[model samples]
Target chain A: MSADVLSAYPASQLAIREVGLRDGLQMTARWPSTPKKLEWVDREAAAGVRYFEVGSFLPADKVPRFADVREVIAGVSRHPGAHGIALALNQRGATDALATGVQEITLVISASEAHNAANVRRTQEQSLAEIANVVRLRDEAGSATIINAGIAMAFGCSLSGAVPEDAVLRMIDRCLEAGVDMVGVADTVGYAGPRQVASLCRRIADRLGPLPYVLHLHDTRGTGIANAAAALDAGCRILDASLAGLGGCPFAPGATGNVVIEDLVFLAETMGFSTGIDLGKLVALRDIPAGEMPGEALFGALAKAGPPRAMSWQAARP
Target chain B: MSADVLSAYPASQLAIREVGLRDGLQMTARWPSTPKKLEWVDREAAAGVRYFEVGSFLPADKVPRFADVREVIAGVSRHPGAHGIALALNQRGATDALATGVQEITLVISASEAHNAANVRRTQEQSLAEIANVVRLRDEAGSATIINAGIAMAFGCSLSGAVPEDAVLRMIDRCLEAGVDMVGVADTVGYAGPRQVASLCRRIADRLGPLPYVLHLHDTRGTGIANAAAALDAGCRILDASLAGLGGCPFAPGATGNVVIEDLVFLAETMGFSTGIDLGKLVALRDIPAGEMPGEALFGALAKAGPPRAMSWQAARP
Candidate 1:
């Protein structure tokens, strides 16, 4: 059957970016050692995961787990076609990330003022200015690293509550005007349903007109993958997911985890969009994180239920 | 916002059928006492849930939890606008269910031969014959109860693997020819993705030309609510969900639970379809199941994360 026969989106291929090392580690108290993190990257790359958010360039005191960001990037760089990404909150962070020779740097600013302040201790305008400076620094340094501005709480916010669609679009516009390579809309608190996701993402897509947007979703209220599906329906291509559904929004009380990368691959591939990631290998790597944080709860239904019997389960593995 | 503005389906009013008391209990070892089951029904009824699958009429030895099916029905009958549904495997089961004066009796027959045999110890044709017999008996007794044929494993089967669309369509046709009032498609193994659910449901709807289909989903692989959303997009109004996402398929190994009723309501209402079920009350009732089944896992994202701040949380209460 033709791919578009069932697809609501225009794209024939879907891109899934791994965020377990960066986003997952940030939420957990325990951190995988640099070697373990590199091993995780290598295993995932073997499973055909080309893109990864290796770690963040935050202060070592603020996020000690990601202090080895350079090592992580160097490890991922060994694999051909493996694009290592890092998160940068300010000009200093961006400069540090660029020095590591990372292919991409994600700059985040929450659409909800309360969430932005709570998360970054800065006003939205201040964050926007920092993003512009980071872009300029990258241009001056002649870095080829792509800048992806992640609009956090674009759907809704835990601290500030309902984020207006106009506010989110305005944020996207500001980020675009700052000369970022790409932009991502994140449901930081997992407050979005499929309709809200589809409507808002479609609106942004319409405004951007060919400029692709990524969906960074959390399953806080358990609408993560469904919202991702709706985002695809709204023309989203790149999806941010964590292995074994790791990570949680510290601001959103009772928020559990990010959308399970394994499940998201299942959803995308099963819906006729090729994700190019091996489900078996990704699901198997759940053990790596679980081993590091012994008592921590890891989640993903595919790891437990196995693949659907209708498909060639054995053939899906490497 | 008008319901149809965002809805892909034509229905403005959505029907949520609570199956926690029956389907949820079937695979569970702990049975809430008859009184507890009655209380559960009462609480849900008060929460504006109009339909419920109260019990199944299997042998007491096979399903001892539902031995007091009559008592459960009697308890639900007191609430006005409340419709009590029961499942029956054969003529004997249907006759027993009919004596209890249930508003609806669902006859289950898996679309897959292997599953049908394993589930009911009968071939597909034999089960179909029994359903016909049950329908004839209801007609002869002049019972006003609607007969719903629930085609299990309609999406895909763990036992028999990929069930062809034509096989499912033929089964639906046979059930329709058997004089059943309505038919429901069940993802017995949680093997369905949104695309398959939407495509097949749409095909069935197109062929039937207005026959309302119910979606019986399992969260085994964590696609339950997403599949529920797809079913709605395909014009399905009746959704079978368990409170606290209770229940699992005894036959399907490691299948976790049905779609969470609380999350489904959240999804439906958030998507502009008015389910008329109070989310606050239903969420509170999760405690009853959790209390009765100690150490047993109860699943739902809304119960953990609380309601989305976008909605008027206080106003959702009865």
Candidate 2:
């Protein structure tokens, strides 16, 4: 791990990008309505969550949950400091997303060819070409939307096991060459442990220099928060999580959900790092999803057992 | 983290002491029969788990699951390399446990006074005095069984939250003064995170010098494996885990179970440390518990998703 890169991070701050609206809602059979989603954004932004993956730009017929991406983006615009991000797979989605005046767009490509084919029905190379086209489209449109290239299945794939580190590095190079502002590595199927997460993050940080790399982890194997801690120790700062751990792999049904953002906030706060999230308020919002989608399994430890009473979030951070 | 202590650990070795028979069965309403427990011991021993906490020397009326502790000890004696350990809270239990010819006896005392009283109806001072009495009895009886003082709620307590670090260290000093061969720390109510676990373990290691320290973690907050990883990184080697993540806190109902031995084994193995336990064998034994208690919640991701295909225990270790 490079001390320089680590030092570059705010000594007391960590950024948590909430993906519950995008990654979480897509897996649900029944999801929050557009009005409910907008309410969620408003409540979350008011609760001090700065980054929200509000929705994904995709075919409405395929994913009805994200059909109101434009409305959701418009709702997010009311908040001054809240940065709303949306996902786009190609030029069409990017063009549509830009029209909504969203600030950031994430272009995703799977490191595993099989996963890419299964997820988007395109090869890794084809997905990269499409991502490049999206980047060109964003640049040509003179949109200030930041393009963050997300390398899904960066660790290993459910369909194709043992994605080589070299393959992930090569994809990073391609994403960088194609004009991505930042790169994010994801364990799409959550097949990683702490050691693997730490080793890969360190290698990526060493190679990427100062370019920000995010770790998007799933808690499938129950090692997500552990892996996140390992990634932080290895100097990879940005992380992606969902509220109440509300996501699952549509392909692998019973796998665990994404790392719970509430627990992640507790972890960061407990570790003495400042995440501006109000733990009490963030945990309280879990009831919205739970009430709306009854019988949906919500996961998090901090919610079950309150944070340690010794450390007051306000006093410790301030 | 002390690099020297971590490097000093036998490069390829880690010790996992299975506490399922004592901890898991105690919480279970309907547990395996005496013969079934002996079979579990034998099978686990055959599968390369060397240390087994077979039972506790508590009254049969209180915990019917451990009524056959003597028989279990005799059964474990048949396995040449497998070491059998049992819990003893007082001199009477210690004497009885020694009479059973067990290889080791663990004397437990809670770091919090409230928890100590709630658990055993004794104060910390009373428990410490009883432990001292047990040490004297063991030495007077010419017993060779190893004595380990397990400090429960060393991190925090459910009955009494915020167990000060000073209190834990004071208890450790008292336990050492009481003539125990080794000392173990436990998150009896599972209120600890990785940072706390690491800091406590590092402090314990620094204070104890050459004395061995063990970490007994519960998965109540889903940070169990992460805590285990942090302990390993902090130079603590011995760990206690229950098979299939069984065992709940009788005090704090609805709290999560113990750290699953199978998942801990996976974490250790993935981090390049060798725990001779067989993943397939450990996972298969989960069925024994699940079958006996039909509605029991058996947890572990490895059992559901299987180990990563790239790393073979046979090839990686051998």
Number of the predicted model whose lDDT against the real structure is largest: 1
Q: After superposition, how far is residue A260 of candidate 2 from its true place, in Å?
A: 2.0
Each prediction's DockQ? 0.36, 0.33
lDDT of 2 by residue, B1-318 (tens): 111222223334577988998888777768888878888888888878877888899888987788899989888889886778899877778989988868788998998898889888998889989887887887887877778889998877766667767778889999988887778899987777788888888888889986667789988767788889999999887889988888876655655678889888888876768787788888888767887777777877667656665564213211
Which residue ranges in model 1 land beyond 4 Å of their true spot? A1-12, A312-318, B1-12, B310-318
- Writing each residue's lDDT as its tens digit, candidate 2 over A86-170 gives 9987788899998887878888898888888988899888887887787788778777777788999887877777777778888
Which window of 10 residues has the lowest lDDT sum in candidate 2 chain B? Answer: B1-10
* Model 1 lDDT per residue over B1-318, tens place: 011111222255677889998988876769788878889989999999988898889898867898898898988899987788899878889999888878889999889898888888999889888888888888888887888899998877787677777888899999988778778889887878787888888888898775577889988887887888888877888789999878876655555788989888888876777777877888899878888898777877778777775574212211
> What lDDT score belongs to each candidate, Candidate 1 first?
0.81, 0.80
User: Chain A TM-scores, all candidates?
Assistant: 0.92, 0.92
Question: Which docking class does model 2 fall in?
Answer: acceptable
DockQ of 1: 0.36
